[model samples]
Target chain A: MKQYLEIAKILKNTHIVGPYWKLKLSVSELAHRASSGQFVMLKVDSDQGPLLRRPFSIHQVKGKTVELLYEVRGKATEILAKMKAGQRLSLLGPLGTGFSLCDLSYVPLLVAGGIGVAPLVFLAQNLRNRKGLAILGAQKKERILCEKEFKATGFRVKISTNDGSRGFYGRVTELLEELLAKDTLLRKKAFLYACGPRPMLKQTIMLSKKYNIPGQVSLETHMACGIGACCGCVVQTLTGYKRVCKEGPVFAIKELTEEGLAE
Target chain B: MTPNLSVVIGTLKLKNPLLVSSGTFGYAQEFVDFLDLNILGGIVTKTITLFPRQGNRPPRTCETPAGLLNSIGLENPGIKVFIQEKLPYFQKLKVPLIVSIAAQDEISEFVELAEKLDKERLVAAIELNISCPNVRHCTKKSNVKLIAQDAKATALVVKAVKKVTTKPIITKLSPNVTDITEIALAAEEAGSDGVSLVNTITAMAVDVEKRRPKLAMVIGGLSGPAIRPIAVRMVWETYKKVRIPIIGMGGIMDADSALEFILAGASAISVGTANFINPNVCSEILRGICGYMIRHRITSLERLRGAIMC
Candidate 1:
C-alpha cells in the first residue's frame, strides 16, 4: 500500500549503529508498509530550496517509526542539519523495488562502505540464523559503528579503513577477496550483496566475478521521485536504461555495464 | 453542487485547473503509471522542435535559495519523430495533452512544426514558446513587440496548422516583458484559441568557486515557487485584457495556491516546478481540491474561477 507521511518527529543522532545517525520519524502509514530495499523522498521546504527531494533507502521500520541515514554534503543537506525535532517535513514513500530474499537459501556475504552501511544494518538484523558475513569499511576505526550488534546477531564482521587507522589498512574489497580465497566452503555457496561508493562497488563486482560468485549491488542516483515515474534516476544496465528507483536499485552483478558501475 | 474547482479554456472543460508544466513533466507516459493521469486537467510535454536536441550537459539543475536553474535546452526527438515515435503513448493517458514548441531564429520554424503535427489528432493543442530569449537571436527578434510578437507568430502558426488540423492553439508568454497584457491582447488579436502564461523567467546562478555561471548555457530559466507571485500578477493582468482564454501557471503547489490563480482570472492552471520536489504533487493537489469542495459545500469547480476578493 502507498502512503504519504508527515514527518512527526525528526529525531537526530539516535545512534543506531556507530557514528551514523538514525533519523527516526513518526510515519506509521509508510513505516508499516515499507520492505527491505524500498526508499523514501524527503522534502526540506515548501518552496524549491532543495528543488528535489532526497531519496533515502529505508534502514529500519518498526510500528509507526521509520528511519533513514545520510551524510551531510551540499546546501540541501545543510538545511536538514538545522531542522528541529518537532518540525514537520513532507515525505513520500515506500517506493522503488526493494530487495527480494523470497526463496533463496545460501549464506549471504554483505559488503558495505562508509555511509553505504546504512541499508545493510536492518537486513543483518532481519536475518537471524542465516549464516551471514558482513564486511564493513570506513576511513578510520572511530567512524565504524555497530560491530558489537552484528556480532551479537551472528554475522562475522570484517572491518577495513583507508587511513590505516583501524582493522585492515586497505579497502574492504581486499578483505572480501581474502575471505573467498581462505574459505572454499563459504566461497562455493555464498550469495554476495553490496552497497557503497561507486568505486568500491565496482571493485566488489570484479572480485565477486573473479571468484565465480553471484552478486547484487544497490545503486544510488539523483532522483526526483523514489518510484519509477520520474526517469530522473536512470542507470544504464546490460539490458537497457532502467530506473534505479523501480527496476531494482539492487541489480545482479552480471546485469551491470562499465557505464552503470562508473556512474 | 456549490461549484468550486473546474474551469474552462475556450471550449475545453477541465475537471480542475492544475496541470504539470512543460519540461518538468517530461512526457505524461513517464509518470502515468505512478499517477492517475486522468486526475489532472492536462500535461504540457517538454518543448519540441523541428529537430532533436541533446540538451545541455549536467549539472543541468542546481538548487538556489528558493528555486532551481535548468538549462535542458529542449531535449526532444523533433516533431516528425515525436508524431511518429512518441504520440501513440498519449493514447493511454486520460487527460488532454498540450505540445510545447520552441525555435531559436525564425517564425517559420514554429510554422513548420505546427503544420507537421496539425494533421494528426493525437495532441489536443499547441503551446508556442517565444519567452526563451537566451538561445541567440531569438531575444532580439521576439522582444520587438513583446507579447504581440508571440501572438502574431502564434496566430500565423495556428492559422497555418488549422488549415490542416483543427486542434486548439495556445501561445505561452514569457514573464520578462514590461507589460504582459500587451502580449496577451496581441495573442487574442492574432486568433489564438487560448494563452498559457507565464513561462520561466530568465535568470542566472553563480558557482562560488569559479565565480562563473552555474549552468552550461550561462543563463537558465528560473522556476519553482520563487516565481509564483509574479506569475499570478501577469495572469491577472492578462485576464483583464484578453478576450480568448488563459492557462495560468508558474508555482502552484496546493489547492489553495491553485485557487489563487483561478481567482486572479486564470481559466485553468499548470503545476510547473512543484513536481520536481514532490512526484505526487499533481495527485495531492487534485485530492486537496476535492476535500476543499466537500468542506465548503461546493460542487462544480467553475464557480471558484475568478472568485478572489479584491
Candidate 2:
C-alpha cells in the first residue's frame, strides 16, 4: 500500500486491559488505505526527546477512523497514554506487507498471544464470507485482550491462560493441537495465521508444519525507520536476512528458519 | 523572486544545499512514493563496500534521549551487486547522485572500487567514508585502522582513489579523534576536492540490569539532535583550516538546523536521522531555507554561508 505522512487527530485514548491502550485516531487518508497486518509509525510527542517514531500495528480500521492497540513499553508509549482527545500526532503509515486474504477455500484460524492480538483483531474484522476461529492466549484472565471484540466479529473464540482462570489451562499451541486432533475436517482444511512473541510463533509454526497446513506469521523487531531505509529490522529467513519493515512484518510459515525453535 | 539555492562543491554542482546523508537515505527509492526526489539538491546512497557485509547481530539500534545509537556495521550489497542491481534505479534520478564508498585495509581495494564507479556516467561525485566506527573487525590490523583517525592513512587512501577517478572526491571524517581539523587538512592536502563531517560520534549504551552493551557490536555511532552542536563546531573549525569546501552533517533535522551548519561554514547540508521522523523533511527544509532567504531579502546562499557573528 502507498504510504502517507499525516496529522492524525486522537478521538479517544482508553485503557483496556492492564497496560494496554486503545488509541482511536481520525486519520481518513490512512484509514482508507490501511489493510490488516499493516502498521503506522507514531511520533508520540511534538518534541525530539524520544527521537524515533514508534511502530504500532493497525489494530482496527472502520471507515475514516483507525485504532491502535499498544502497551506502555517505554517513554514513547508512556507519553501516548497521557495524550487526550483532540491532540494531533505525526503518523507515517500503512507500512510493510499485510496479511493476504486470498484463498477462501481453506478455513481461517487466527492464533494470538497476549498483545499479538492487535493485528488479528483487524484481520477478523475484514474476514468476509467466512467465520474464522480465533485462539487467544495470555498469562492469566486479566491479561487476555479483545475476547468480546473477536466474538463481536462472529469468530468462534477460544481462550487459554497459563493459570487455570480461562477456557483452557494450557498454552495456545496446546489448545490448537487439541482442536486439530479432535476435528479431522479442521486438520484437512485449516489455514493458520499467528502473531505473538517469538517462542509462541515458533511453536505455532511448528504445529502448522506438523499438521501439514499452510500458515502465515507476523514478526516484530526494534525498528528505526519503518519505511525500510534503516535495515535495522531484519530477520533471518529461509531465503536470507529480509527486512521486516519492507519485505514483511508478515511472512509465510515456510519462509522462516526453524533452527532455534527449541530456545 | 526565488533565491538561487544552487551551490558548487569542486566541479560538482547541486540544485540546492539540502542533501539526504548517506546511510539514512538508503538508495533514494525508499522515499520516492512519499516525496519528490527531484526537489532536493542531491542524494547520497548508503556506503558501499568491496565485499558484501552481513552487519551486526540483532539489537542493531537503540534510542537515547534525543539521540540514536546504531551499530549497522555498514551493511551493504557489495560493489558488484550494487552496480548490477542498485545502480540502474539511481541512474534514473534527476538530482545529483553522490555515491559513498567504504574501504577495507587495502588501498588497492579503494582504487579498484573507484575505477569501477568512475566509468559510470551517472555518478556525480564519490564520498570516501573513512570514519565508520561500528565495524570492530577492522580495528585489529594497523593497515585497517580507520583512515580518518590517522593523517598518513587518510592521505594514502585519498591519494590512491584520486589517482584512479576523475570524479570529485569528498572525504568523510570521523569525530572520535582528538582533533578533527588535522584530518580535514590531511584530506585537502591529499588532493580531495571537499570534506564532510562529522560521522556519528563513537559512543555506547549499556543495559544496566543485564550489565551488557546495548548493541551487539559493543559500541555504535551516536547521532540525532544531540550531535548538532558538535557538528557545527567541527565544521566551523575545519572551515578555518581547509581551503576546500565542507559538506556538514550530524543531527540536522530542519531548516534552522541546516542554516546553522551553513552559517557555521558548510557549503551544503545533509539531513540524516530526521528522515526517519518525516520522509518529506528535505522538501520542508528546502522550503524553509527559501522562506528565510526571502524574508531577509537575500538572493543567494553565499550571503549566509559562514555569516555567523562572534
Candidate 3:
C-alpha cells in the first residue's frame, strides 16, 4: 500500500547479456521502498501505441537508484531499448507482494532462468543468509546472466545452458535435481526460490514436492492496472483465480493449480 | 483563470467532471497513493455482484495495438462482503462514491444488489453494469444477449433497480450493440438518471505462432484509444436521443479526448485505461481541462457541452 507514482529519469540503459537490457532510473522515492520480487510499471514516454504501461521486476537498487532488467520483447521493450539517459519515464512502483526473507535456519537458494534473473539479483543481495546458492540458466553462455552480480553477493553461483555453452548443460531444473538428489542435507534443509519460464517454474514445483522442500515462484502475465483493480494478470489456484498484480507476482509453489501455467 | 468544471448527473453533483472509471481505479483505495481522491468528481468502485465470483480463467487480458483486451468477468466480493469490508474506505474519501454492480441476467439479482447499496450513506449512485461482454454469456438462451444489448431488457433492469433504490441510477451501455442510442433512450425512458457509455467493445486476438487465442476467454472487451472515436460517435448519438446526462468514456487519455466527449454531449467524463498507464492521470487530465477552459474563456462546462461544430 505504500506505493508512489513518480517520473523517473533513465540514468543508464545498457546491454549486459543476450537480449538483456539494464535500465537504471533516478527516482529515489520509487527505489526507497522497492523490495525484491516487487515490480514497477514503466510507461513509454512517447504517446506511442501499446498504450498500457509495461511491468518490470525490480532488478537491483544501489543508493537512490533502481535498476530494471528487461528482455527486449515485443513492441514495448523494443521502444524501451532505444531510450537514452536523461529521458524521463513515468513509473508506478514498488508495487505488489515481494519475496519474504525468513527462516535463516533453512539453506537459501535463488533459482533464475533467462531474464527471470531480474528480480533475483536484488533478492540475492538482500537475503540475510550467507552460503546461499544462486542457480542461473539461459539458452547459451552468451545468454546467461547475473553470474558475476550473484557471485559478488557472496552466494555460490551455478550455471546451466540449453546449448551447453555454460557451466552445466541441460535445464537449470536438471542441475537443481542433481544438486538436491546427491545431498540429503541439501534436500531436507534447502528452500528453493525461483522465477523463470513457466515450464521451468512448473518443474521447480514438481521438484519441491519430490524433495518435500518449500519454494516460491514469481509469475508474469499480461497486466493492465498493475494494482489489484483491473483483475487482469490472474492465475488459477486451489482457492480460485488470484491476480498476479495484487495477490502476487510471487506465490507459493503449493497454492497453484497443476495446470495453472497453461493459460 | 479557473473555469467552472463542476458537473452533475441526476441529483448527484460533482466538484469536477473527472471520475476514475470503475475496474481501472480499484475502489479508489489502490490509487489513493498516487493522487488525492478528493480531486476526482467521483470514484466508481469495481463492479460488484450479488454473489462472489471467481471470475474467468487465467490469461484474462492481452495487449493489442493502441488498446487492451480484458476478460475479467467481474471478479469481486458479493454485495454483502463488499459493504462489510470495502465500503468503509469510501467514508474517508471526499468524492462522491458511485458503486458499479453486475449480476446474472435475473432482474431480481440486479434489484437486490442495488437495494443493498442504497442503504449505505456513502453510495452516491449505482452504475448498472449490464453491458459487460461476460453478461452476454450469462443468459440461458443460445442466442446470447447482454441486458444492455436489448432495449426492453435494459429498460426492465433499470426500472426495477430504480424502483428499489432512491439513489440515482446510471445505466452503463455496451458498444457491441447495433445502435447504442436505442438502449440509451430505453434507459432514459425507464427512469435512469443518466447513461454511461460505451463499454469495452467485443474483441479478440490470436497468438499466431502458438495458434491460440491470447485471452483464456478467447473473446474479451476491447478498451483504450482504439475505441475512442466510436465512443464519441455513440455519445453524440445518445445525447441526441436521451434527455438524461451522458457519462462518456472509451480511451479517454487526456483533456483533449475528455473535451471531445463533452463537446459530443457527455455531461461528464470518466478516465479508464489511461489510469492504468498513469496513476495520476485524473489529476493531470483535470488540470488539462481547467487549462483549456481558461484559454477558451469558456466560463462554464455547459457552454462546451455538446458544442461540437459538426
Which number leads on DockQ?
3
lDDT score for residue A81 of model 1: 63
Sort every candidate by TM-score, greatest first.
3, 2, 1
- For each candidate, the DockQ is 0.21, 0.63, 0.85
Residue lDDT tens for model 1, B107-127: 667777777777667677777
> Considering lDDT, where higher is better, how would the candidates rank from best to worst?
2, 3, 1
Root-mean-square deviation of Cα positions for candidate 3 versus the true structure, in angstroms = 1.5
State which candidate has the highest lDDT.
2
In order, candidate lDDTs are 0.73, 0.88, 0.88
lDDT of 3 at B144: 44
The digit string of per-residue lDDT tens for model 3 on A15-39 reads 8766789999999687778889999
CA-only RMSD, every prediction = 5.3, 2.0, 1.5
Candidate 2 Cα errors over 4 Å, as ranges? A46-48, A181-183, A258-263, B136-144
Off by over 4 Å in 3: B136-138, B141-144
Name the 10 consecutive residues with the lowest summed lDDT in model 3 chain A.
A254-263
Residues B186-296, model 2: lDDT tens digits: 999999999999999988999998898888778889999999999999999998898898999999998999999999999999999999888988888999999999999
| Native interface contacts kept by each candidate, as a fraction | 0.24, 0.60, 0.94
